[model samples]
Target: MRTGQQPSGHGFGSPGAAPRATNQNTVLGRAMGKVLAYIALTKPRVIELLLVATIPAMLMADRGNVDLWLVLSTLFGGWMGAASANSLNCVVDADIDKVMKRTAKRPLAREAVPTRNALVFGLALGLASFAWLWWRANLLAGVLVVITIAFYVLIYTMVLKRRTWQNVVWGGAAGCMPVLVGWAAVTGSLSWEPFVLFLIIFFWTPPHTWALAMRYKEDYKAAGVPMLPVIATEEHVTKQILFYSWAMVVTSLILVPAAGLVYAIVALLAGAWFLLLAHQLYRGVRGGAEVKPLKLFLQSNNYLSVLFVGLAIDSVLGLQTISEMFS
Candidate 1:
């Protein structure tokens, strides 16, 4: 309507207004970014690996006749427990995370979340995890969940991580607690079988973590963390990895008496494959050949995933039926 105005279509009131769209987009993007940052604080991949080991433990404990609702509830509590520990670990290592290239993008490291807020969030999840498991699973399961969170937050993150090269070796004990939690959730008791499952992961951690550390040696060195690869010769570190790899394979086999034939055969084959990969990495490093340590690292993930899947399949087949095949 103005003398020189041909159209008012581009004005603020118009549907096509650029400023309004941009402002909305900016607000939405920031909100989604914050949500993702909070999720990242929980270290989702590690939690996924924890669950892979957990469900199988439960399945075996209950002879594949587990109540689905119980399984779901136990999984939720276990996830919360793991997430709480990881979030708190992030808080404790925020300063070190900023120094490590591998961990620099984490929430506290990048200041996406306030340290106090992250700490509170972690504590809240821990309490919620305990309450949920106690109500839905059992007291023993809840107690185990809390113990793991405490160990991971106080012992591993605070005490061992920066102080020693054996950090992952021993710190990983906290990660193994989920198997026991899963077993207790189903049976309302702990047993040698679940303890054996716990040791498989306990031995598995060092090789898995150290392999990744080999690739990020500089990151740990710069962060002043004493990861084995950062402080030791490749020869020494590779030997250590092999030591743990052997322990992992042997511990996996130790489950055969409880799990029976199908799991035994799968564990034997999978353990062999895992050991092969582990040896290749060591031998390559030993002989001055180019090696991809992360190759072993990635396969280690696959190996554990497969091993647990085999356990689930064995449970489904019924341990007695599977054992009958060999008789």
Candidate 2:
């Protein structure tokens, strides 16, 4: 009936052996290592990217007149849900992580954490997240949290990821859910504003991810993942990247009706800049030059962050949407 085993030689053990006293420094170091290992399982950087788009969506939903407590709760709940999904993904991808140099240092891949522990931790966090969001935000937000986690884990990680080059295109749906979760947290309902925000991320995900995948093509190949850069020609993949980049830019414009002048200006200007780099990368691919895709990858992150920050600022500034200005 033992769910888990105690550390060996704790109390009951071999004959006549005295229990070893725990060294405080060693204990602290071990505890700290466990903390970091668990943190790695959550992939904090990716969660940060997901969360970057969240609060702004909340601000936009409520028009900057948000409850501080609600915002805090939503942010925390978003982090929890993302953390759960990431942890479960780490566990699922442990085999591939061991093969891919980019992921080899992950805690599970490195054997710093047991798979069972990570699975239990991930599941526990998911249940806790649902309860927290339901109590702190609303039932709608709570339901969205569960749906996102399930989609990310079951669809993206398990089904679509290794099966096709278009995996990110569809699987990225889960990543686009946070804005919905955020908007739902604020209004307890749905609208076009949040859907516009969702599309922005939906189209943004492929290019941002494909850019990184291009850099790690070998890693994906070695790990048997069918990422676009792994199975397709550089020209073909970069072409798709350019296509998605422009698609994302066009989607950003759709938000102008809801987001207003500040966001529109940033969207037009930043979207142009983002496309410039996307085209530049495409050009490098068409020619024989080194594309250095990570540049575009980094820029895409900045582009999304800038757009959302602009939206938050616009809401705070009480800027009117183009639709409103016309009316």
**Which structure among the candidates has the greatest TM-score?**
1
Model 2 lDDT per residue over 82-189, tens place: 999999999899999999999999999999999999999999989999999999989999999999999999999999998988899999999999999999999999
Instruction: List the pairs of residues colliding in candidate 1.
Output: none
Residues 1-327, model 1: lDDT tens digits: 879866667765676687778999999999999999999999999898777988999999988575789989999999999999999999999999999888989999999999999999999999999999999999999999999999988999999999998889889999899899999999999989999999999999999999999999999999999999988899889899889999999999888877767788889999999989988888998999999999989999999999999998888767574445566
Cα RMSD to native, each candidate?
2.1, 7.9
- Model 1, stretches more than 4 Å misplaced? 1-16, 319-327
Error of 2 at 189 (Å): 0.6
Q: What is the clash tally of candidate 2?
A: 0
* lDDT at residue 189 of model 1 (Cα atoms): 99
- The positional error of residue 12 in candidate 1, measured at the CA in angstroms, is 10
Q: State the displacement of the C-alpha of residue 221, model 2, in Å, after optimal TM-score superposition.
A: 0.5
lDDT of each: 0.91, 0.90
TM-score of each: 0.94, 0.92
lDDT of 2 at 236: 92
Q: Where does candidate 2 have its weakest 10-residue lDDT segment? A: 13-22
Can you list the residue pairs that collide in candidate 2?
none
